[model samples]
Target: MAPHLGDWRGRYRGAAIAVVRPASTAEVAAVVRACAEAGVPMVPQGGNTSLCGAATPGPDALSVVISLSRLKRVRAIDAANNTITAEAGCVLQTLQEAAAQAGRLFPLSLAAEGSCQIGGNLSTNAGGVQVLRYGNARELTLGLEVVLASGEVWDGLRGLRKDNTGYDLKHLFIGAEGTLGIITAAVLKLFPLPRATATAWLAIASPAVAVRLLGDLQASFGSLLTACELISDLALGLVRKHLPGSSPTLSPSSWHLLIEVSGGDDAQAGQQALEAFLAEALENGTVNDAVLAQSNEQARRLWALRENIGEAQKIEGLSIKHDVSVPISRIAEFVERADRQLAQAFPDIRIVTFGHIGDGNLHYNQSKAEAGDNAAFIAAQSAVNRIVHDLVHQLGGSISAEHGIGQLKREELLRYKSPVEIEMMRAIKRTFDPQGLMNPGKLL
Candidate 1:
């Protein structure tokens, strides 16, 4: 209970009377039933790696924490079906490895994949770099096995890809953040393993150029463009400073794009295509400078530059973080306008910006430029949030893109969502958990 009381960010501390580890869905249902019958609240926890405190119990000590770690297992893999059934406690990286072992690809990826659980990934509908090619968790999931509030296990672990049944019940629980039920197991969609891959690091002029390059690459490469990330110069500097051996492959510039293309066919042709496209981009001044990875090791190093942004920022200092998105067409406008607006509002603030721009998501963070106590500056979170979120809203964007509306963004959800939409969500919550025992104080 003590260990399960805190979230990954240490931003939330909770209290639970007991932390129960269930080995199977039946055991989970039994525990849930007993807790509900005893009038005790419950919080379903996965890897405890949630950034928004979704897995952490509330401050009240009345709830019981149900840890799904003991249920880890890869139930089945149907390569022909292109789906894998995994238990709730399966670590995301292990699933990815299992898919690779079976010569397939499970593409729900992020920094926390090493520690985050499959259930949490589905629960949050997490988005990642490959979202440009492979959709988010919700799209990749084919079926779900969940335990309802009353301990009834809804065995939805079907691998059929074209089951146009009545209502899609899996969706209600996938992104519900445990507000509806406990996600016990899931059947996730997988793709053919990429046999050939090419990666590049490019220095670009601005966000507008990055957007133009993205459109051009999409037009040229189509589905081969698996990932396209945008990084600011300051974000790269933080990586170089905090992560040893993290050197830029390309010359320093104001902004950078870490682009990748993958194909299951010939490696040489894929490499040639990517290089030819880059040559054209460079010739047209669309790319100021670029470096292409000649080997797998170099590709990994190039990816580390983009993948290490979160950890780099963490080492730098406490910062206000926003996982947001706008329409792809409006991404450049959003960045330019948000930068100007935030610069005017908070002078001398270090803005660390980077994310999967291929899909219009951005991990925009801010902190005091100088390394000192930012407690006072952190106190202005609401102001900072209002400025950023308001702009996102006006541009028809989402405040929480990959991360769900856990306890961290509940208030923001209320502010951004319409009354009718909020009411619909509340109605669904009531229909699913009438007793309100499932993950209280989350999402809603």
Candidate 2:
């Protein structure tokens, strides 16, 4: 429990009877069955990298943590079907590399890809920057191999794209956060590897302008617009301050956009189209300033700025964080309203806002400029959450976006979810896990 009990944020610690390492599907089933017979609750753990304490056991000290790290394996790769079957413990980055090795692309990407596990990714339905083009972990997944709470192995790992045979059971497990069953393996969708990729850093005026630029890019480039990340000046300042040797990607502006476009199998294809668009965009006054990467090295540096925001925030101080999403058309409104509301309540509240704006998700977090005051500011988390989440609700947005409703958001979920929807979810939980043995005190 020393390693698995704590989440990536180090904000949660759990007490479990023991942590069990299961190497195979049979072993996982056996362990689950034993726990079932003993009437002991079981927590299915992956890489222990969840932001919401999903994999961490409760403080009861009565549950067993089933660590799936030992089950790392690429079970099979069907490039013809554009799918790959991987075990629960396979690291997300390893799966991405494996897909590239097979001349395909597995587009489930995030900063934690190197440490996060496939099962957990699917379980949480993680959405990264590429979700603008591809989709969330749930969309990339085709089928699943789950260990039911009864200890029965359900092998539904079929790579068929048009399986409307019945209810999409895989979805029940994906994004379920292990409340229903354990995701042992999955058949994940893949795409043709991009031959040419272009990356650019743009100085934007505001969130509204970013949205306009996004629409323009999508209109011209279509689905080739792979990623569009939004970073406020405050967020970028944090990156520059904490990440040594990191320089600004463009002239300092109120906001910066890290954009990328990818096209099919032409190593030299991306630069020209992006260059043309930027030329037109500049002439029309959609963007303030821009720097198109001349080389992959430059591109990586530009990307590092966006990827390192979370780390920079950690180096600064504790913060109240909210991963919320609104409709793409209303993203600017959400940001404007939320920022104004927060500022009115907490003067000089340093706000760090950035995310996959193309997909309508924002990592909106707040802290004080001073490290000591930030600690006290952190105590107003509930108050901060109420303001942010209330506005998100007003905008028809979700309180929890990419992150799952783990123990952290159970109360929030109950508060926001409609009574009928909550009842249906609870009924499903009862049907799937009547004993409440699987990941107790989570999600529901």
Candidate 3:
């Protein structure tokens, strides 16, 4: 008998001979060794929040899943060093709260923060709403402790801000999607907790204007611009319909921008700066309408709309989803070209587009308005992907953005990546896991 493999979205399912829960790093190493001896592939999973099916094992693969849920522990925290060392299974939200309790900030955030684990975040190199300011999970990480396929543990966890001894081996596994090795623990960077914050929701004319507004805000506010998120009208409609207590922000504009500014112990000054920025944006017609939050509750309400987009889409029904990114300067062109191409290809289709415009990543999704023919729409995924990904390639963009090339985009990766880069990746994989037992059939 084996444990049933369940996908996060229920779209793909698999089965494994056993699901082993290791409570410590040593235990994880032992499990890996046993699996290696048996010549069974191992799928290392944490939180199982991967959107790209990377955590789900295939039915044909003889595998044992190493679930790290029990390895949750905060090994150490040094506020002076501005770093926190924690096990692979620590939930991201818990780590953030722990850092906050110590008067520091762990700024890696996503919609699944409550359930997603740090190891999974590192494996995927997650980029969330705050990427515009704090960068991606890879940027936030300082070091990692990984369990290689041969059961050897690579202890590279150090909290130093400056280290240039030799080759940065930790970088090899940060976004490798567990193909090379299993991450056991990590030393993550922390930031100073901003004492004051201001949030605003602005209605913009189109993606072009949204890009312009992003430039304006970045030029004026600089590092104080903590987040600049983009949401489209169709995506917002899904939220208002499915999620309770959700309402329209600005009379249903075509596009919306959620902006935040934060600094040290000066709420009034932050608010003033936001007001001045918005005033100037309005005077120059950069924004059509704007609403600033006067209270924390109000700010939370504004964020709820942006956070609920994925949930709303799930409730609506099956969709062909894409997590793509282009240069900030080419976002408008990408969107316009993608829209026209998709519409012409599928006349009776709905495009629900939205994402972190400041980071040039968009969750461009498509499905039928009527729920009855979702299967047909989903079946057309290959054709649709060819069209969309071709455009992304022409624009010098990535087909997969925050989401890693799990089982879903493995072929696409080969199609887009150069032969030399692919060979280099294969070499690294061999150097780390020669047997190909660690998270087989992923990334490379």
The Cα error of candidate 1 at residue 306, in Å, is 1.2
Q: Model 2: what TM-score?
A: 0.98
CA lDDT of every candidate: 0.91, 0.91, 0.89
Q: Residues 79-179, candidate 3: write the lDDT tens digits.
A: 99999999999999999999999999999989989988999999999999999999999999999999988998999999877899999888888889888
Question: Which stretches of model 1 miss by more than 4 angstroms?
Answer: 371-373
lDDT of 2 by residue, 145-231 (tens): 999999999999999989889798998998999999999999999999988999989988999999999998999899999999999
Ranking by lDDT: 1, 2, 3
Write down the lDDT that model 3 would get: 0.89
Worst 10 residues of 1 by lDDT: 368-377
Tens digit per residue, CA lDDT, model 1, 1-444? 577899877789999889999999999999999988998999999998887889999988989999999889999999999999999999999999999999999988888888899999989999988999999999999999999999999999998788887998999998899889999999999999999999999999888999999999999999989999999999999999999785656766899999999985899999999999999989988999999889999999988888888888888778998999999889889888888998898888788899989989998998986655477778899999999999999999999999888898999999999999999999999999999989999989
Model 2 regions lying over 4 Å from their true place: none
Residue 273: error of model 3 in Å?
A: 1.2
The alpha-carbon root-mean-square deviation between model 2 and the true structure, to one decimal in Å, is: 1.1
What are the clashing pairs of model 3? none
Task: Supply candidate 1's per-residue lDDT for 93.
Answer: 97
Candidate 2 weakest lDDT stretch, 10 residues: 244-253
The number of clashing residue pairs in each candidate reads 0, 0, 0
